[model samples]
Target: MECFFKDPCFSHEEEYRVVFFQHDIDHNEAKYNQKVLFREKSGIITPYIEVRPLTSSKKLPIQSITIGPKNNVDNAQVGLEFLLIKQGYDSISVERSRIPLRY
Candidate 1:
């Protein structure tokens, strides 16, 4: 999914990164590793991850989130399918290119 900076004036797309989570961790949990480094450089860093829609011909972000499972299939795709099922979808078809991460 796409992520935009919380700052309204920060419109430079290069600063954004697309992250995929392996588990059900929230925004804070995901960035725990980078907390110390960021805090040292920038005082009281309050970074957040905002989920964005996936679109065709979209420019990819430099960074991505990953969890340990070591699966060949993309965990992001698997997460989407699972979410669909939980939301009462009988069957979900994930296109190789445009799988929606959220409803």
Candidate 2:
């Protein structure tokens, strides 16, 4: 389980993580492996894993996306909406963070 975590020292890589743990089964050899895949980007070798949703739909169960507080958040929201639409994500609800941005 701890292998899914990242150290703060790697923060400079501009990497973000999306984690999903199977709650029903302890492990699924058919679905996943301990193998970590690597790819070179911007002269940095990044480690990542391929995660497939264990559902008949075979799609990531992403229901919504909440953009965090920041300046020009509306522009960001619009861009995200356009991206979702382009990607054929019809049902996802795009929302803005209610937390007011304080400069």
Candidate 3:
């Protein structure tokens, strides 16, 4: 799945970041809760996340995305990259290691 902002005014650098996940949890069994971290070029941080209860009767829609803040642009990119890595998209690499906030 691809994600991009609807507005044309956003410059290439101002685009929001997004990550897609194919969850392994069974829809009938339990909800999925994930905490994702966002880091800035200067090392400031933020988090964007989602929590969803599993459903048994039908396939849950991927359209149920939760959009996050657009203020901290760099942090948003870092958060998206972090989420992608956690979800097994291993091709990306973190150039520098920084601890993620837990709250």
Candidate 4:
């Protein structure tokens, strides 16, 4: 995906870096002291990977909610209806709110 940022002065070109996940290595292996390199778009390369333990020292719960498509009024109404039905509010109707907009 392409991303753009607005600059008030637009004085100089901006620089961006991309990072990707590499393979995991074992610490007790023969080549445990090896280093990995990452290449940039400008041909400049640098070491990126560092071998470490495969354990999380902290415990935390992650929560997430999935939402449906929201392209137009009808699509948004359908998504809202699904959410309402899941929440035990199936009596709600989107057709009741289909009145014409003033502007």
Candidate 5:
């Protein structure tokens, strides 16, 4: 069975996620004995592991990024572009949402 699946009924929702594995975790080793970081949210503590994506290139393989419906979408686009360039990520397409968001 597929661990991750996209439902056609919820196509409008952006559900992109990255899963971490043992090999993926092995790549992100530290000089110290530190590995996972624990965080408490809503009185529940969870372990957060650092996983670096395995890509042929150094940059992430995200070709397109969609900005969801929210206030200041134009500003968000500019900020996204700046962040991409600053992070050495290139050849990415930025698009705005068309769905009527009522929030």
Candidate 6:
């Protein structure tokens, strides 16, 4: 389904699928929340991401990541590049985003 999380100044629209799988394990109340996990359409799991809301409503949602911690086997940068290539992303853009603590 298509879900839109938009702001007055910016908008983000994306499609996400949710499925419940049968596993041999007991369920717990703390297992699920509003937490979201993004996966590739090819069924390859990507790195773990933590999305944090901006302090001001004017900014778009920003995500922070810890790459190596999730897949500690290979170099973090190398693993990321491999995953992106497999997913058909030919290029990537890296930008420096910083917010002052006092701001």
lDDT of each: 0.44, 0.72, 0.47, 0.46, 0.72, 0.41
Clashes of 5: 0
Question: Which portions of model 1 show Cα errors greater than 4 Å?
Answer: 1-73, 98-103
What 10-residue stretch in candidate 2 is worst by lDDT?
7-16
Better of 5 and 6 by lDDT: 5
Pairs with steric clashes in candidate 5: none
Candidate 1: minimum summed lDDT over ten consecutive residues — where? Answer: 59-68
Give the better candidate number (3 or 4) by lDDT: 3
lDDT score at residue 89, model 4, on the 0-100 scale? 57
Error of 4 at 86 (Å): 1.0
**Position 38, candidate 1: lDDT:** 26
TM-score head-to-head 4 vs 5, winner: 5
Which structure is stronger by lDDT: 2 or 3? 2
Per-residue CA lDDT of model 5 for 42-74, tens digit only, reads 699976777566876766677788887787898
The parts of candidate 6 lying over 4 Å away from their true place are: 1-74, 94-103
> For every model shown, what is its TM-score relative to the native structure?
0.24, 0.47, 0.24, 0.25, 0.55, 0.24
lDDT of 4 by residue, 1-103 (tens): 3334434332232323445434445444335335564657448766577445344833222122223223366776777778766765566434422233343
RMSD per prediction, one decimal?
Answer: 15.4, 9.1, 13.4, 15.4, 6.2, 14.5
Index of the highest-TM-score prediction: 5
State the TM-score for model 4. Answer: 0.25
Clash counts for the predictions, in order: 0, 0, 0, 0, 0, 0
lDDT string for model 6 (1-103, tens) is 2233433322222223334532326755355433436668458875334544465663333233223223233465666667656755545532222222231
In model 4, which runs have C-alpha deviations exceeding 4 angstroms?
Answer: 1-71, 96-103
